[model samples]
Structures are given as C-alpha cells and as structure tokens.
Target: MTTFSITSDNLFMVSLLFLIGLLMPTLQIAGGQSIGVCYGDHGNDLPPAQEVIDLYKSQNIGRMRLYYENPGALQALRGSNIEVLLDVTNDKLQELNDPSAANSWVQNNIINYWPDVRFRYIAVGNEVIPGGSAQYVLPAMQNIQSAIVSAGLQDQIKVSTSVSTVVLGNPYPPSQGSFSGDALTYLQPIVQFLVSNGAPLLANVYPYFSYVGNTNSISLQYALFTSPSIVVMDGQFQYQNLFDAIMDALYSALEMVGAPNVEIVVSESGWPSAGGTVETIDNAQTYNANLIRHVAQGTPRRSGRAIETYVFAMFNENQKDPGIEQNFGLFYPNKQPVYTINFPQ
Candidate 1:
C-alpha cells in the first residue's frame, strides 16, 4: 500500500481553517445580540448620570451611545465596562475640521477617561450630510480620524458618522438603491474613508418611517418583521422584512460607490410606544423583541456575520417634540422599562 505525504503548505492551510473555525463562535457572541442603548438626555426628569449607569448595569446593557461628551456622564462610566460611542455635534463640526482642534477635543473629551470608560467609537456627527450642514461632514471626520491616529489610538477607537434614510433615493427593490442629488457628491468620499479605515457605515434605519410615510405600500407585519406575509422580490433575493431590505439597499448603495465590503451598523432603530398613528405599547414590544431575535440570527445576505445594533433610546425624551419624537424610548424618565424585551446577558 502506498500513502501520500502531506506538504507544509497543505498543513498551513489546514491550520488556518481550524483557527477560523475556532474563532467563529467567539466572534458570533461578540457581534451577536450585544444590543446597545442610545442614552439621549433631552429630558428634564431623567436621573443623574451615576444612577443611569447603575440602571444600565442592572439591565446587562454593555454598550451606549452618548450624543456628546458629558463630563459628568463620562465620570459615571468609570470602570463600568460599557463600550461607549461618543459623538461630536454638527455645530462643532466646523471647529473639529481643524486638525489641532480635533486633537484638543479628543484629548479633553476622550483621552481623559479612556481605558476606564471603554470608549470604542467617535461618531463625528449625526445626519449632517445632505442637509445645510453637509459641507462640514467629511473634513470634520478626516480631522477626527487623523487626530485619533496621531494619538496612537486608531486601533482602539473607530471614527464614523450616522445618516438617516433620507440619503437614499427610493431604496425600494433593494438592488436599485443609489444615492442621488447632492448626497452622492458627499457620500462617495465618506464611504471610501470608512472602507479604508475598516469602519462600519453607521445608519439610523427605521422601518416605522417607511410604514407611516407610505401606509398604502408597507404593511404592519412586514414593517414589524413579524412574518414574511408579503414578500418583495429583488432579482432572486426575497425580502420578508423592511429592516433587511433597507440594509441590503444600503449595501447596494455602497456597492455602487465601490465600497461593497464596508460593514453596516444600525446605530438607531425603534418604535414609538405612543403619539404616532399605529404606535402602541404592544407594537413597540413586538417590534423590539422581534428585532433582537432577528439580529441574533443575522440577515440572509450577511449570514453568520453579526450586524451590531443599538436600540434608538434609553428614555422617553420629554424635551423632544411633543408627539412621536418623545416616545421612542424603551424606558420612561423614571428608568422604568416601557415594555418587557429580552437583552443579551
């Protein structure tokens, strides 16, 4: 009997495969339903920063997004082990456009409490492009990212910006998604920067808006991801839920811009429990619960590749507009959950 010998190259390939298989589960857990909460403090009755941190600890939420650097809140996060996504306001974008100013801002806001606070990302601005604030976005992001690089903190912290669905040009059918108007001019370079930096394309994707805006076209079940009750075909792919459709459309848009490999992060998505039409406690509960389970399994296109997500808000903001804007929170100002939903332990 003759036996064939295994070559060194073949052995190396086998080892690489084994290593990949070994790390897959850990990556899944890290990127899975590691749900985050957006800590928007636009309310007068909300508790103190320390109390809010304690509340998050009790609920096992390991990530949170703060719209700006709040010294008090940053102090509260000391040793909290919560991964934080800190933001720079749009008004401050012009200032941050300067490299020196960006460095100083990072040193003051981020470097001061870094390792202890677990700062993970610096979101340069929220929904700045495609609006009057559009001109400042890219320069601000470049300066911030460069500042982080100069500080030798690029590996620890990512720099990204979030955009709403308003940037898309009729994103239905998914495959035909592309940025139009003035948005295209700004979006291309931004996506390129994200891809080069190995950062995600942060988006605030809300199916609720689609449903409310086109009530005749979108159904409640489809928007809520309750069932594949109405399937919309895009080429050979079948879209059963609005969230996946919107996400794939974004992916398609990235492909159009030559950045198809860039990952996406659903920075904000939630249903208001009151104020808007069809907005109720039951629907909110169903939406969020189903969202958690759906994300845990990943989307069809990105199977086994977890798409990290953060729920829209931590508390109902009384200071926001009286109607729908104030009601997106999973909790009330008193730190009480609006409805029961599962969170990763």
Candidate 2:
C-alpha cells in the first residue's frame, strides 16, 4: 500500500545517521559524552577546590580541563568521576624532556591519583607551537608517553599538546586548509607520533578572535551559530557556522600532513561576557549554549561524530591580564554563574 524511493539526499542522511550511531558508544571513553568546562584557579577570591567540584557535580558537567597538576585540585577530584584533560604547563615542557623527570612527574601527579581520578588526556603544552617553546613540545610528549607506558597506564591515557589555530597558513574555504611552513617543521613529527599512538590533536579554537579580527568579512551570526542558512559552500560540504568551518579547516590541515585519521579535540573555546567588543551576557550565553549543542553534531569534514570540547573557563580570573582574557569564564569569581547555561548530561 505504500511506495517510496530513496533520493541522494535521503541516502546521505541515512549514512550520516548510521555513522552517528557507531560513534555514540565511543563518546564517553573519548570525553565527548558531555560538555566540559575549563577550571582555572587564577583568582584569589575563587572558591575552594572541594566547593568547585561540588559546583561541577551540581551542574551535571561531566568533564574538566585542569591547567596543571594543582595538588589541591587533584586531591579534590578524587572519586569525583569527572573526566579530566590535564595540561603540562609550558614552563615544564623543557624539564619533561628528560625521561626520569617525566616519570617522576607522572608518578607524583598521575600515578598517585590513579583509579580515583579519571584522566582522559595529558596535553604536553598549551599553544606553545609556532613560538620559541615549539622545539621542546615533541620531546616532552615522547618522554611523557614513555613514562605513561612504564607506569602501565599508556592505554588508559593519551598524551598530546594543545595548539592554536594560528598554526594554519591557509584556513579559509575550509577544504583548502594546510599548516604553515614554519609550523609544519614542528608539527609533522608530532602529528606522526599522535597517529601512531591514536591520540587526538588538542586545538584551542576561538571564533571570537577571528570574527573580531575582520568583522566586515566574518558575520557575527556565523560565529555565534545563529545563522539561518548555509554561509559557506566548500565543494560538496556545506557549512552553516564558523565553528564547523574552523574545525573542518583543521581536519583538512591534518589530511595535508598525511595523517588524515588523526582526530581533533577542541581544548579551549568560549566567548567573553564583558570587557571586549560585542561582549555581552546575551551573546556569551548564546555562543556557549549553541556550542555545547553543536559539538555533538560534529563538523562537515568529520561528520556524524561528537567533537570533544572544553569551554574556557569556569570562573573569571581577576589575576589574568586585563581585558578579554579575564572575562571568558562562564561564572564569576564569586561562584555565581555569569549567565545561565545548560549542560546536557
């Protein structure tokens, strides 16, 4: 009694949904099951570590990005069940190049808290590439990996570094993305190492900076994911938001480096609520809320898989340099939400 024909669009939709189903199971293990928030304790007036953990539990936030091995924070995180993306601060990168130092660092910070603290990834350095500290990144990562293997935790935790979008030479049009010559020298081997170890590249993607840099060309609606229609068409892929376009660009860059399979984890992304251009409570809430919902849909280039992301950050840091840097937090230093944001469980 019923007859139907599957069009190309229908087939594509079916394929996408099937791929999504396959990816759903891996989300939790990969830290993509729910949105994560970066917990930066740079302000003197911030709450105690235990109170912060309690806040996270109350909000249903499933993951956290810790900037370093803060003894107090690590102690508070025990048995909390919140997956953590721990960072190896830039200052410690060169020191970690020594295998013994790396092992000791891991033994003290990670091994000491094992089973109680769920560590997902150990980012060797944050946005240190394309700078003077670039040379030490790969070595530190190698040493850390060796340490992790020695501790019998190699399979449980991944080692990588957080990089900025500045590493991209040509990022526009998404499909034509490629790493800059300067950055490739530092990133090539790192990419290979990540591919071999099955670790994702941590990237700090900030569409806010891109939009503000060139407001005439980049629209706010596109950056905020409020666009009603497709904004950019790159070959067969259609991009409706800047976040997906930027992510696809990174994906394309990885492909150019002969490591197309290397996955990307958004280590930091957020909008400021004040102290900058177009920074307002409404805009910040819109951007973050939309980002949490959109990451689950994945990017066009890497369709049907959730993109693990960490919003930067939990509280506004008064200690940070004045301006937008201090205003990216989702909550105030007093522990009150700067604006209401819902995190899906």
Candidate 3:
C-alpha cells in the first residue's frame, strides 16, 4: 500500500519535542479519537497538503501535529475528520505576547481557516525553555496565552509549549525530577496559566537518546518495553517500561509543585529508522510498533495509568535542520512504511 501523494521534501520537517507538563483534555484510550502524529515539515519538495490528507485517510490516522499553521495545509484538511495541533517558532515570541499581534496572527492564519481544520491545540513554541541560546522563557508563553484568549480560541484550541529532556535537572530515576532553576522562572508561570485555561502540558520524549547516550547502562529490552517486570519506583509509583518510567518522573515533578492533577500529554514520541550503529532499523521498528500497541491497547503501566503517546512522524523529511539523526519517519518520502509500524489493529 504505497501512498503516492507524498513528495521528496515531505520527510524533512517534523514538529520536534523536547519538554513537557499541565493538564486538560478529552483523553481516552482507543475509541472515538485515539492517535496523534507529529507532522513535522522541514522539507520543500513534498506533495501538496491535500495529497497528504488523502494518505492519512487511507491509513486511518485522525490526529496531526504540525510545526506551524501553514494555511495551505490547514486548508487541505478542512472539513476532514482530522484534528491538528499547530505550533509557533521562537522568532515569533515577541509578537506572540501582544494581544493585537496574536489576534492578527489568528485572523490571518487561524480564524480565517478554522473549523475547516478544527485546530484543537496551539503549541506556543517548540522547546522554548531549553532552546539553547534562544530560550524564550516567560514572555513567549504569556504571548501565546494572550493570543488564545483574544482570539476566543480557548474553547476550540488549547494553548501549550513543548519542552525537551534537556530542560530537566534530572530524569533517569523517574522520581527525582526537577526543572532546571533557570527554567522554573519560566515554567512556574507557564504551568500557572495552563491550569487556569484547562490546557495540557506536553513533552516530546525519546528513549533513543538515553540508549545512545549511555548504551552501557540502558538495555535495549528496557527501551523497547520488553524488559522483565523487576520494577523501579519512586515512593509509591512503580515503573516497568521506559515510557511509564518517564511519565512517572514527570508526574513526580508535578506533585512536588502541587499540580498533581495537571494533565501531562506525550506530545511527541518515536524511534528513528536511520542513525548510528545502535540506532538501527530493527530497533526502530520494535520501539515504535510496541509503542503504538501500548497506547492503542490503553495498556496500563505499573503506575496504573493508561499510557498515551504520539508517534514521532508519518513521513521522512529531507530538509529538516541538520542534527544527530533527523530522518526518523515511520514512512519514507515515497509513502511506504519505513518498516511496518503495525499501528494497532
């Protein structure tokens, strides 16, 4: 089943994730609406947005995560059943704080093209807190919040900011977690607004980075959620798979901050097809296939919470910014499975 609508550049840009938190939602396991896909588009020579929409229908994918409100793409999915979570870049931080600017942005990019696209979430910035030298801090978040309210998008589109793992002071133990002191100055306010607005906090996690960083300590079985149930815990929480372990860590951090009910959403998570010797195709397939199944089955972790996840990508992007390994698409630019992800039956 090759989807011919995709183009060469389609595999390049995938809205990436690096940080996470907050809680709001219509979260559920496998019925009504169940899957989320990061549709990062850092490429140029790809199929028209409408063609890609056709491919999604053929595959039964209902949710799409876009890096920005590319009106052309939004227009393509209008009236379709898909839900989109559009993002904003760091460069727009200043403009985002101004209600007028945000209103204009929406009037031009969103209001003019909503309901058709059904924008459900608007991620203010991608990993802004730890954007490394481009840390947008508090203002960007406030700007986005202002825009959401001014545009009267609070009911239709929740506002959020995605963060990366680097923002954490510690993440391994799954319990001893804390935002870097520097990030707290920004996160404190962000979470405050999130809770008030009924928005979810997001994190884009990758066990791949842990495995690649400490191959000697992190086992492949652990990363693939195949590790035996010996168990790891912090206080009363028990963790088995890397996903749960990470979630527990985030949960614990929230508890520490007295925001226990704050909803945490795995905004982006996945395995890559091509990378260093350790990041092979087989490992990639195992990781993603299991993840899709885990989330699909609404399988419970040791914590007893049904895990929710968004697979990293739908297509490989050729023009994504240069990085350790950016070509992590589940499907190639030709629209063939990178391997069979086996999205749940």
Candidate 4:
C-alpha cells in the first residue's frame, strides 16, 4: 500500500474522517428518526419561551409535547418546524363534549396555528381513565374529530388521549396484558375511536415508578436499560429492558381489545435525577441516552418500526410537589442539562 506524506491540509482531513467514523454508530442508530420531549411549564425559574425554543433547536430536538396551550410557547413555536403534541387539559374534557365548544376550542388553539405550529397529535386528556373525568373522553374525542374534519385538518392532526399504565389490569408476562373491568369500560370505546380515526393511542409508560413501587422485584439494571442479558422471556419475544416489555404488553392489550392494527405512541417515559431511591444523575443520563438510541429499533412485537416516544419534561419543575414529581426533567430550569445525554439528530 502507498501512503501520502502528512501535511497540514491532509492532516485536517484525516482527523475529520476519524471523528466521523467514531460518530457513525450513533448516527446509524438514530437512522434519521428523532424522539420528542415533553415541555412542561410548572416551574417559576424556567427560561423564556423564545429561549426555550432556541435551546430545543440548538439540540436538534424534532418534536415537542405541551401539556396545555400556553400562548407564549405556542407563539414561539410558530414556523419553528418542531412537531407538537398539544393537549386539552382534563378539566376541559366535559366542555369539549359539546361539539360547538369543541369547534371553538379548536379555533382558538389549533386553527390559528395550523400549517405553522406543525401540530401532529392533539391529546384530548391525560390519565383520566379509571377516574371521574373518564366519562367525557370519548365524547370529547368525537367532537374534536368532528371539528377537525369540519376544518379540513383531520388529515393533518390526529386526536387521542394519554392514559397511564395503571389502566392495564395484568401487564406481566407481556402476553397476559389486559385492561381491568373499570378501565376497559372506558378504554374500549377510546381504543375504537383511535383505530377508526387511524390515530395512535398515547400511553405514559414509566418504569421508574414501577421499579420504585416494587424495588425488590425489579432490578435497577433492567429499569435503566443496562441489563447484560434478557431478563424476561415471553413466547418468541425476548425483553432486556423494561420499556420494550411494557410496550409489548400494551400491544397485547390492544390486540385483546380487537384493535391490533392501532399504533401506540409513548407519550412520556423518564427517570429522575434526584430526590428518590435509585434516582441519580448517572442513572438519568443512562436511561435517557439509551432511550433515544433504543426507540428507533422498535419493540419485539413490532420490529423494524420506529416507536414515537417523548421523554417527560424539558426542565425540572420546582413548583411540583417536592420530591420525584419535580425531578423527571432532563434539563434544569436554568436551561442547563441536568445530565449529559445525546438526542438523535
């Protein structure tokens, strides 16, 4: 083999090539897919709306989830090219049950921002199933779908509700996952609504809470995506991480409900950085970084398809009840990262 002599110009090219080679695995892992981050504004010291949007752009975050329609954040998002998952708070579910009210709500929040704000999904309510607000979920979804169709935006924005994993009565073994009687009464219609409208069911899947609730049974390595080998084997599928196991369970639940064709979007998943057991900076970084890399590979039940996932909270909210509720943020309220983690570009 012939080699050229080293010069200043050739040396720079060589270094650049080496750096690219090192980054190739990460780039391939992402495969041009980017995960979303939930942007909660429950803090008193968080950055301004424009600055927060700029920070998202700086990190190449492609999607965002807003818990409600905060005008400042909505205004900053205009023309930002960041896809949004906007939510109508649980309290508003009854109001939206009226079609006219739903239309007005859409007009005020979504219609004005359409084609500019890039809203991809509109979650009608969050974790309302198995609760008092459960009654209004289906009606609100129907009215919102009607309004979207009336506005000719149904093709652009999908409507769904976010449900907590508590809805699942039996979620272990990945195959026995099914909704409890109470949750099924509410979820069956909701799942049908999602399937008919071709919208994915949004589920807030959190392994941190699961592990915290049953620390003796759930290993930290498995919860943090560091398990050396498969921890749970169900039929033909093998699960090494808690996230995939939970997702496959969800898929099984949907299939039992006769909605196997419907997709599931992970509305929120995260580990805390402090204020609780096993909640450390290193664990948070490891969890979030591995999440960004793992979601593109999908779950065992739905291999090769990228799972649409959103990590919870852009910043830790000091206003939340003191403890883990305030600690799920990947970044601090001061616009600094709580731990070093890479997002897919």
**Model number with the top TM-score:** 4
Worst 10 residues of 1 by lDDT: 10-19
- Looking at model 2, how many pairs of residues clash? 0
Q: Write the per-residue lDDT of candidate 1 for residues 1-345, one digit (tens) a residue.
A: 001111112111101011122212112222323688899999999999999999888877889989888999999999999999888988899888788998899899988897898888888889876888887889989998888898889999999998887787757557777776678888889988998899988888888887777655566777777643435766777777778888877888888889989988888888899996678776777677667667766665666666678888899999998988899898898877887554546
Compute each candidate's TM-score over C-alphas.
0.89, 0.90, 0.83, 0.90
The candidate, 1 or 2, that scores higher on lDDT is 2
Give one digit per residue, the lDDT tens place, for model 4 in 1-345: 000011112111101011122222222236324588899988899999999999888877889999998999999999999999999999999999899999999999999888889999999999998899899999999999999999999889999999988888877778777887999999999899988999999999887777677555666667777776777767898887778878888899999999998999999988888997578776777777778788888899999888898988799999988987899897888887787555547
Which order, best to worst by TM-score?
Answer: 4, 2, 1, 3
Deviating ranges (above 4 Å) for candidate 4: 1-32
The full ranking of all candidates by lDDT, starting with the best, is 2, 4, 1, 3
The TM-score of predicted model 3 comes to 0.83
- Report every candidate's CA lDDT: 0.78, 0.83, 0.65, 0.82
- The residue ranges of model 2 lying beyond 4 angstroms of the native Cα positions read 1-32
lDDT of 1 at 129: 67
**lDDT of candidate 3 over 298-321, digit per residue (tens):** 322223444445678877788875
RMSD of 1: 12.9
